[model samples]
Target: MKAFFSALSTLTVLPVPRRFHQCDEKSLAASVVYFPVVGLFVGVLLVGLLYFLKAIFPPLVLAAVLLFVLVMLTGALHLDGVADLADGLGAGGAPERMLAVMKESQVGAFGVIALVLVLLLKFSLFFEIIDKGRWLDFVLMTLLSRWAMALAAFLGKYPRVAGTGLAFIGKISLA
Candidate 1:
């Protein structure tokens, strides 16, 4: 239960009990298993919102609303990662320099372009999915993406000696 709440609080902007926000390293590692569950919860919300707004708004507007809801639900967590990675890679130098670039507070040109491209891609896809009435796809997409995060955590190595991601990276296992 603690692990589930930890995962939920970490992954989303949705409010959780304050106690759940303070977790031990073990609980944080255990929380990996609940990532997909959180995704499923978000997905259900998106689908429900889609159904409720489908009749009220045109397809394009409905898609934009659904995309906005999804971004808000997760608090744009993944998007930050996307922008950071883009900034790092775009710097295009030694590994150390790339890491330095990524750690900077200000976003660079690559970050802006990457964010724009990602959001545009998501909006376009949402428009198509809504037009096709494929609501369930949204659910499956969220679920699988979070599951993939768990898998990556289990398989990935933490680059820095200490950082936020260190709590999960290399700590999760298939068990």
Candidate 2:
């Protein structure tokens, strides 16, 4: 239970007791298992927000608000990853140089472009899904994307000797 709570706390902006955020081998392991579960919770919240606001706001306004809520709720964790990955890929040098670029706190041209394209894709996709009346598709896709994050963690190697991702680098399993 503590592990699940830890995962929820780490993944969402939902108020979690500070004590539950403690990092330990046990909680780290449990958090991976709960990663998708966190996404499911997020997706449900998004779906609810969409329906509630759909009747009150124009589609464009609602889409903007929905995007804001998601980015805020998740604290842009995945967005940060996208930016880092973009920097690493776009650095166009030795692997170490790319890694260093990713580690840098500043966003590069590639990072900005990547983030913009991703957000634009999301915005247009949301518009189409709403037009087609496919709310369930949105929720399911959200769940699937988060699950992919867990998969990536399981398969990924740590770029640096130590960092936030080290916790999951060699310490994950499908089970």
Candidate 3:
């Protein structure tokens, strides 16, 4: 039971290879399914925060607060990955070059643009939800986005040069 919950916990965030060393490719795919569940928690928290502030503030302000909370909670990990991916894709280089660009620590113009756009979109979506006073969409988006991230990772070829994600790839099964 404990193990089940632990595995479920990791699936919500980026899975660390160190913790799931024994997971084979097949189980990896199965494990990936839980990310949406993780998103539920994220959405719940955000909604709860919004709810608490609803009496004191407007939806727009609550939306901003929730967004800030999300960034802090997730540590902006996915946003960073999105930025890195945008930088790599925008480089107009070979796959190897693109991979290299992604590996770099610095954020480029593409990364900046991507981050801004994604944040804006997310903020707008959340604002809409808050405006309507619906929490369901918030939870759904969180889960769907994580699932989308996992799908993107699963479908794409793993870039060469081992990193944190490489081990995750090895453990992940495509099913």
Index of the highest-TM-score prediction: 1
Q: What is the C-alpha lDDT of each candidate?
A: 0.90, 0.82, 0.73
Comparing candidate 2 with candidate 3, which one achieves the higher lDDT? 2
User: Which candidate number maximizes lDDT?
Assistant: 1
Q: How well is each residue in 39-143 modelled by candidate 3, as lDDT tens digits? A: 777888877877688999888887788888888778787788899999999997788899889989999999999999999997898789989878888888887
lDDT of 1 by residue, 1-175 (tens): 8788999998998889977655778889999999999989889999998888888999999888988888888899989889999999999999999999999989999999999999999999999998998889999999999999999999999888888888899998775
Q: Model 3, residue 72: displacement in angstroms?
A: 0.9
Cα TM-score of candidate 2: 0.92
TM-score of each: 0.96, 0.92, 0.79
Q: Score candidate 3 by TM-score against the native.
A: 0.79
lDDT, candidate 1, at 22: 59
**Which residue runs does candidate 1 get wrong by more than 4 Å?**
none
Candidate structures ordered by lDDT, highest first: 1, 2, 3
Better of 1 and 2 by TM-score: 1
